[model samples]
Target chain A: MVDKSILLDNKKFTVGIFDDSDKLLHAVNTLKEKGVKIFDCYTPFPVHHLDHALGYHRTNLTIGAFLCGLLGCLSGFTLAYYMNVVDWPMIIGGKPQDISVFTSFIPVMFELTILFTAFGMVIMFFARTRMIHGIKEDLLSRRQTDDHMVLAIDNDQDQSLSNKDILELLKKEGAIEVNDSKEAFNTSLTSEEELTKILKSNKTSTKKTKKK
Target chain B: MYTADIRQPLVTGGKTYSDVTKDVCRPIENKPTPSWWLGFSIAVVLLLVLAGTLAWTVWEGIGTWNVNKSVMWGWDITNFEFWVGIGHAGTLISAILLLFRQKWRMAINRSAEAMTIFAVFCAAIFPLFHMGRVWLGYWPLPLPNAFGSLWVNFNSPLLWDVFAISTYLSVSLVFWYLGLIPDIATVRDRATTKARKFWYGFFAMGWNGSAKSWGRYEVVALILAGISTPLVLSVHTIVSMDFATSVIPGWHTTIFPPYFVAGAIFSGFGMVLTLLLIARHVMNYQDYITTEHLEAMTKVILLTGSIVGLAYITEFVIAAYSGYEYEQYAFANRMFGPYAWAYWTMMFCNLVAPQVFWSKWARTTPWFIFIISIIVNIGMWFERFVIIVTSLHRDFLPSSWVMYHATWVEVGIFLGTFGLFFTCFFMFAKFLPVINMAEVKTIIKDKE
Candidate 1:
């Protein structure tokens, strides 16, 4: 009964492809049409609307920052009040420990608010994105962090896929460079220096043409 | 479609990526020459003089400074205010300018941030060294100690300064360090030695230039820039309050906060320019720290200088219009009193001088701008001197009026602070990649 079922177990695989932002968008759209889910997109610089192309929703990081800021403000006020009024109240100047204390504590409160907001938002962001120390990540393109826009697609259907057809689609959509992740990683690990040399040679040839 | 390309020059004359790396890192990797050593030695000798003076002052007591009954806060306070004011520009350039999306800031922001840190460090020393009993400095902290002392006075502006400066230092460090991470990673990738690689690698936090990490880094940086912009403004505002909150003649004014802020950016940019002009030539980063960057910064200096000039005029007007004898006396004394020479010097350097930048030639020329920056710095120091000393010299009573001057010890310490600043800066230049390598690479790739 299960043999004829349309649903199949999800299998995770990382794919690396490079193109201009427009081409990447088109490839993403084509991938969406074929029911291929995008895992992530990596680029050296930000490409506008790329998140939307990958079907990513708005993140909660900002909301987290706001909440953390509120907490920071409360903590700052509470600490100042407790220390000045309740804990060890000593009237040095004519000013007393009352509402005026709030003004004095504003600097501390401001500092704490910014500190909490920044750290809290960043922590939430990293957690949501599954980025942690020493975690090995798939590289879509070496130049992605320099100039290229990379699309990392995860084909999860576990069905037999036409690799040649996918490469053709990528090429037709104006991909500057394309490579399968598994193949690239195997080549990278086995002969890392040779891989760098190949990249360097390719870069030089491109530079030579521009010189003309 | 691209017919213009055939007519246009194909190869732009600029250093390639490898050349860029080699040129920028030359000063760092190469050994110091005799000239470099000689310059460093002079700075060191000046630093030692400052140290000797500080030691003598501590041994003798706070009485070594020329602060008398009338003028309690003398040259020490003046220098403190001066250094702190100078420190403000760095933060303004790095944080505020970044938020405004000023692309020209990229050339000088790293060095400017470093200057801010060092200047703040120098400013911090004055308060502690002037405290006489430097060991008891921790009493300012809110924590409970063995001494039956209560919590810090939250009401005092001085205490507020302690909090503000410490917070500014910490946040600025984080902002600077976060910006340095990518560049440090670049250095790590280029390192040849195992030890150098390990340390740089450790600080680089295992950065692999992964797109996922870059995505996170960009978001965090944006958020930090957002937070730091307000924090920077608040810091200087709080610093200004150290004077503005006081009831003294020159000190008591609403115009002080913004005036101080403008002066800060003016001086800070001047310092940045001074450093970068030398660095660009010495380090061979003329392309990175381009003429366009200098022009943009020159515009900022001119704008801030005008604002400062307006503040000066407003201050005099406010004093005369207040109908208060002390305020009137303070303003008149600042212009036509014992410190008048210093006042005019400051006016000429900060207010009248920066007006030259209005001309295109002044803004575009690095050497001219560099000299102007030095003048602005001197003018800022004089501004602090005029404010602090001139006001205190003759206060409420005419009988208690007296002239005050900094002793040789005070001068040495002030010069020594420069030693501290430049020593750290020289070391920073030697060890770390002064430019944000990754950020620069991103800009370079944009041309592609």
Candidate 2:
């Protein structure tokens, strides 16, 4: 059961881009104070307390990691036990092949625990974040992943603020650039069918541009 | 956030956030430089040599190499230990240093972790081929099979190694790739060419750098670091157990775990120094991988080298104090017996050479450190050889006592692993941003 909030889905957002993380943080705080709903904020690097300013709860991913770790621990113990005790217990050099010699199983158990925890946590993270190879991203600005910190306000979430008013507010609070997300992104994220159509069109257009 | 009075700026020359991306991603963005071409060609030639030797080994069987009844585990095991030891600095720098809140690590950790992955790949080759029949390598896994439900030995340290090495490699890779995602996204966005955009975007996995994603990413990185700290220690400890559990005198010491772990870190740092010294200079990363960074690494080399030195002394002292004839003979034989040259070489390289780092100039000087780093790598390699060969060359009876020398194929294969390492490193440097631009941006003085 993946949390819906973790996914960055198709939405009409008024995106604000700031050059500095400090400025972005302040803009986010000011927007929150004025009761403007922030859809999500993206930064080139992690800005301290930006999540808190956006009124986001602390991520429960650690809890997921802990559970996965517990699963790994159990799996490790079970595999070792079943293999050594029940399956084929060969007596080598007069040493006992019973549970009393469980000390010997520690290394394998430890390794399995780490292996499972790491893989499991990463899988869970990817699943929750909707991050996968070759997926089309809704990039609001080219510099968003470079130097800019982006604050996106979904227009659907709060109908009180117009796109122009939001842009003005963002610019007033130190955002270098502000624009409607639809104008900025090449591919629209309205529906699955439309998305595929837009992607196919984008591919052909890119091919045409290459030819030219 | 104000700049702290006590802390020197991590990134010098007042680099802005955009400059970090540009500078770090320059190699990936631009055409390969002449130096890069030179290094890549050398690496490729070495890689070809590696491929040739490996194919020859596989085709000709273990008979191609020189392993005898006395020393069944010769250069194969020695090289295995050498490569694995070299792999340790990556995890130590990334996980252990991160856990300790060492900010200097941010500059070196990305490449160090990549080196860890490559070194592990090199290390794995020795053991895999050492099985003689490499096809049945899967036999170590505890699977119920047609041979009447035959399971791998749960008690054997060799089997423990199969689990430990695989786990270490996979976990290190995952850790490295997870760190690489945001940076990959940066490259994807900045990419101009259609091919670059497609490829980088694909690997970037639609990373939007959302606050929610960053929060989770931070927690996961922290947790992974916590787990990997123990995992790294356990890996070498388990590797040591392959020797410690045996009845052989020099190999059967209880101190092998801590001793091996320390030696691993020592050699690992030495290798890191060797690679990064070249990388920092070649890639124009002097500002990022500053003298302070080199100094910090040399300090680790000093600490771990001294620990290794102490371990050697302690092993000898304990062997003599134990009053056991076999144990005492092992130590004395290492120093005065047929392998005296190897023992003394290990002593000078691992123990004596690192003592020069006590001077600030020795630690700070790149040219001096580079030379010493190479020396340290050589010394660590000799240390493993001495431990494995000296213990096995004279076991119980004089009847089986025979001198061991590596055949040409064995030497070639050993040299080939360097090709495999550097080839992978060259590709990584060419394809990816060597430094973590996103992380480095956070610590940039004016930006902060």
Clashing pairs in 1: A44-A144, A44-A145
RMSD in order of candidates = 6.3, 5.3
Can you tell me the CAPRI class of model 2? acceptable
Given candidate 1, what's the lDDT at residue B64?
86
lDDT of 1: 0.71
| Chain A TM-score of each candidate structure, as shown | 0.73, 0.78
Q: Where in model 2 is the C-alpha error above 4 Å? A: A1-10, A159-166, A180-212, B446-448
In candidate 2 chain B, what residue range of length 10 has the lowest lDDT sum? B439-448
DockQ of each: 0.20, 0.41
| Candidate 1 Cα deviation (angstroms), residue B133 | 1.6
Tens digits of per-residue lDDT, candidate 1, B28-77, equal 54576565676677777777887898899889998888889888878888
Q: Model 1: share of native contacts present?
A: 0.23
